[model samples]
Target chain A: MSGRSRSRQSSSVRISDEQITDLVHKLQQLLPEIRNRHSDKVSAAKVLQETCNYIRSLHREVDDLSERLSELLATSDTAQAAIIRSLLTQ
Target chain B: MANSKSAITLLNSTSSRLCFARTSATFASAPPDQLKRQSRRIKMAAYSSMARVAGRRRAWARALLFRLHTRPRHKTLMRRKRRPSTSSDDMVGKLRRLLPGGETMDVCTLLEETANYIHCLSTQVKVMKAISNHHLSKVN
Candidate 1:
């Protein structure tokens, strides 16, 4: 029974390893920063680091845009506010 | 409703901390649980969007702010740590620096978290883009 369970565990680990490789491939494709680099040499960790940096920049961009939107809405007249409110709800 | 309220809260928070570092030593670290919660928040956001409900898209925004707020306190602690080992181990160390709460994770868990993080980030970008496009069209 123990031997059988061990084999099963090993197979599960192998499956997960394959899944990780697939995920790494997907991540590599999504990141334009890493796309120009030699695929054979770039490591998964490097891809992850690039991805983290990309996400951080995107987060910052979103924050900036949201603040600007709020400012525009705040300064605009009621009609503009009504339009945006409608747009958001739709 | 709750979604717009969270967006307002996100706007009300510290304006911007847009530092982009590629290989900086002063990377921030977070507990693994928080990372999991961030992923959960993203899932909630996705579910709401799919259901055509006004969802709290600001969860990731708040998380980003939280990371920036917490960055300074962990710098020295992060730099001081050492784990000397194989080449793959060095790669793991780099990943630990990259992912939030990655410092304590095993390789499997790290990969899982990375997947979730990537998905959340893409969703965030999409949501933000949609919002921006909506507003820009209205103003123009």
Candidate 2:
């Protein structure tokens, strides 16, 4: 398209969901661009490590509750069944 | 919505303080139940607030990440995401896509930085999910 024609057609360039999806697909098209950062492995690893630590510390209380629930049930099928029933009703 | 990022950032910093206090209180307190309850609140508040911020972040991140990938080498072929529909995510994403190419930093640089930021936000969301589950379990 010539500059004049492109200018005339400017308003026609509308972005939509398909465009977003296409943009996402095209962006993935350049994931190989990530190859350039292989040399920065150390910093990337640090980022990854920090992210992992944050994730690891996220649900300690939840884990505790799950653990305590398990202990309370103590391998008793009846206790487990009751808990499941109560949860489902709620 | 204009203050969403700032609100979340403020929340983030405060939550960190609460989390830190919880840690110290855990060691200082002799009682287990009280310590556990306070610690649980810290986790819940941090997770829920961050998750809200992150939900917005993902919207902006997806658009910014896409713009970062496409470089707009051919003006005619440029594929933009929508009008962002909300505030912070859209603002951040707009700033991202508007950065001039063949200028100082390359598209790859900006995209990577934004991607890393988005990745960090997602990690926070996961943590929030875990905390919420924990809180719910306790209520039961």
| TM-score of each model's chain B | 0.41, 0.32
True contacts kept of each: 0.13, 0.00
How much DockQ does model 2 earn? 0.04
- Docking tier of model 1: it is incorrect
Per-prediction TM-score? 0.46, 0.25
The root-mean-square deviation over C-alpha atoms between each candidate and the true structure, in angstroms, is 12.8, 19.0
Error at A78, model 1, angstroms: 4.2
Q: For residues B1-140, could you state the per-residue lDDT of candidate 1 as single tens digits?
A: 86455443332221111101101112234345443333333333332232222212323233334453455642421133555645644655766665555665556556655555555545545554554465567667
Number of colliding residue pairs in each model = 0, 1
Best by TM-score: 1
Mark the 10 consecutive residues where model 2 chain A has the least summed lDDT: A69-78
Clashing pairs in 2: A62-B134
Q: Runs in model 1 with CA error above 4 Å?
A: A1-20, A35-41, A77-90, B1-101
Task: Identify the CAPRI category of the predicted complex in candidate 2.
Answer: incorrect
lDDT of 2 by residue, B38-100 (tens): 544444444344434544333333443344345453331223454645554333334354432
Candidate 2's error at A15, in angstroms? 25
| Candidate 1 lDDT tens digits, A1-90 | 221133433556645666777767676776778867776688877876777666556546544544444443333333534443554456
